[model samples]
Target: MNNGWFYTAEFRDGRFTQIQWQRSGQPPQTTTLTFSSTNGQGQPIYTGAFQAATAVTLVDLSGGNVQPGSQVSVEVEEWGWARGNCRR
Candidate 1:
């Protein structure tokens, strides 16, 4: 329960865009959160989705590295993607 890094989200077009994270020493980071409603004087402001998520920790990379607990798995998918919407 020490090693870290484990991000995974792969929803395209309408959302998620892309998110990836791997950890062994760190050097695998990606950010791509897509979804827009416009609001800074543009108008319309509510049309993003993704309403559920749980905890995760599974890992296995072997040759490339990263090997945490063999394989438990529970990261349904996430890079936050603004996580369930909340902007003010």
Candidate 2:
């Protein structure tokens, strides 16, 4: 995540589901997810609700091609009070 959230790259059924996010003490919640593209299997453009603190998954694909400092971006509405963008 752009907020520096470290996430796993796998999900149940063995698919690379999402770039998941979750903060300590906060239970995972669901939100709508949008994917830019599908994998080589041709899953197709996907949009659906998922569970996590703030999931930014690619739905049913791998992020193996995504490198650090890549152009991929994450948008946050507003960092909570005392949580500056560069701070955490």
Q: Who wins the TM-score comparison?
A: 2
Q: What does candidate 2's lDDT look like per residue over 9-83, in tens digits?
A: 323333334434566666654444454576576543333333434223343322434333322233333431111
> What TM-score, computed on C-alpha atoms, does each candidate reach?
0.22, 0.30
In candidate 1, list every pair of residues with a backbone clash: none
- The segments of candidate 2 whose C-alpha lies over 4 angstroms from its true place after superposition are 1-17, 30-32, 36-71, 80-88
Instruction: Using lDDT, give the best candidate's number.
Output: 2
For candidate 1, lDDT tens digit of each residue in 8-81? 64443323344465778867765444433444543222222222233332212121122333221222335422
Clashing pairs in 2: 18-57
Counted clashes in each candidate structure: 0, 1
Q: Against the unseen true structure, what C-alpha lDDT does each candidate score?
A: 0.35, 0.37
The regions of model 1 sitting more than 4 angstroms off are 1-3, 8-13, 22-24, 29-88
